[model samples]
Target: MDTRNITYFMAVFDHLHFTKAAEHLGISQPTLSQQIRLLEAELGMPLFDRIGKKVVATEAGSLLYQYGMKMLQAERDAKSAMKELLSEKRGTVRLAVLPSDLDFQLVPLFVEFKTHYPEINLKAFSTIFVREEVLSHKVDLGIGLRGPADKRLVQVPLGSEPYELFVHSDSELAKKSEVTLEELTQHALVMYPKGYLGRDLVDDVCKKHGFELDTVMEVGSASSLLQLVEAGIGATIQPRGLLKQHSTWPNIVSIPISGPAPIRHLELTYYANRFVSKAHKQLSEWLIDFFKARTS
Candidate 1:
């Protein structure tokens, strides 16, 4: 029941060898072995099977191992959250955000977060599948086009915006106030690679019309894709926010997606009911307000 015993059990369960586990724990082999024996005795079943020199968890031990790992991790997280909350002056908030051309959204939010919490170190990862990262404790927070289905995540509604078609100011598409899904398929396109959210949406629209997109180029960054468009290589489609802050770009122009447009939702998500530090709480509040403000 004691955490020390739990730790000892996990250590053994991880290494599957008493001596290595004891070495890692900085305890002697015999002492760790004795503790394991005591734990097995108290449980009324063998926790491990000794096959020659190798050790493997018994069926009961495997079940308990799962619970034990969660317990220790929860304890560690509790201590960390308490430390940050009680200290008040500084802490770290690890965040994962989709690399979905985040300059217009994430950059400003980060600037605001830094200005308010000057002492808090914000470590961010540019990634997709933001929800899984938070659940596994890989990061404390995330922002993405879509959030996780798991109940652990608390979603903060960020604004939604319609997709825009980008073309060189001299291009035919730019001459129109809006571009239809059918009209778009007439031109060659440049966009993110397949499997990305933006590309997936565009592909779906094309499919709905019983056609596939004429994607001539596939680049990774938004700026690069826009540059290619600006050079009149191909047209591109993306969220309006990706280019909102770059209003001065002379050649690139955006037109609305016509004929029943598809909109993408932006959201900030964090683990629900988990002990967050003081800085995290304030930042989460600020983020909610900031995103909600965008909606308004």
Candidate 2:
């Protein structure tokens, strides 16, 4: 089977829509269809079945997809290995990080990595769906909250930190070193929407304690949430590490939550079996050490 055709097939399989897959591949829809047809003819079996507006993969297509990913990964590994034979320091490492304080907090570390390996290209971005990006092979590494068990992934626990109350320095709650969950509910709060990872962590803890938070506003951006708190709108609960980054902002205060505080556990995850290039391996090791130093 042609590797190029296998690549096209996988794209179609992923989207289950010819037009969308074509768009993603930067090819015209007709061209994409022709490629699929050629691939099917070579295989001597139908790869996809069209049912009305939907496209579904056949058993043959499903089986091919499994091997197709491995084939693509092998091609990548070969290219990386050949490149390193010429210059050991050259390659790209795409990384996705949590779309919260953790994203911005890691900038210094990223910069340090770049300084050490100037030839390697580093592309980093923030997203709430870090695991999804890594799992889909869109990113080589992910730093985010713990995810559901997946044998295809290898997760290295970074560390866990407790959620603390962030309030304007002028607020009475800021005068205390810590506050109980019950006392915290007495105050108005600004929080992320229900489905957000950080919000869910807080919500789960509150549910276990038999009372809900008195949330006055729901904001999605972590920086916006802190801005609202600084404006004295309402308090927000976030990991203490987040507050540490904003320590220079005199108006905001971080108060620990007393008794069974909600904790956010983070991990660095990647494909368990995917090839690890030298640049990728170096950055991963650096990050592991960086987090270790921070938590220690």
User: Which has the greatest lDDT?
Assistant: 2
**lDDT per residue as tens, model 2, 1-296:** 76899899999999999999999999999999999999999889999999998999999999999889778877877787888899988888899887774546777777888898899989997788999888877788998888788999999988877888999999999889899878876898999998888888988988998998878999877888888998899999988878665455689988988897888878899999877887888889988776655554
lDDT (Cα, 0-100) at 201 in candidate 2:
90
Please report the candidate that would top TM-score against the real structure: 2
Tens-digit lDDT string for candidate 1 (178-218): 87878776788898999887788778877777877778999
Clashes of each: 0, 0
Scored against the true structure, residue 14 in model 1 reaches a CA lDDT of 85
Q: Where is the poorest 10-residue window by lDDT in model 2?
A: 287-296
TM-score of each: 0.75, 0.89
| Poorly placed runs, candidate 2 (over 4 Å) | 147-151
Judge candidate 1 against the unseen true structure and give its global Cα lDDT, from 0 to 1: 0.79
Please report, in order, the local distance difference test score of every candidate based on alpha carbons. Answer: 0.79, 0.86
Reference-based lDDT, residue 118, model 1: 90
| Lowest lDDT 10-residue stretch of candidate 1 | 99-108
**How many clashes would you count in candidate 1?**
0
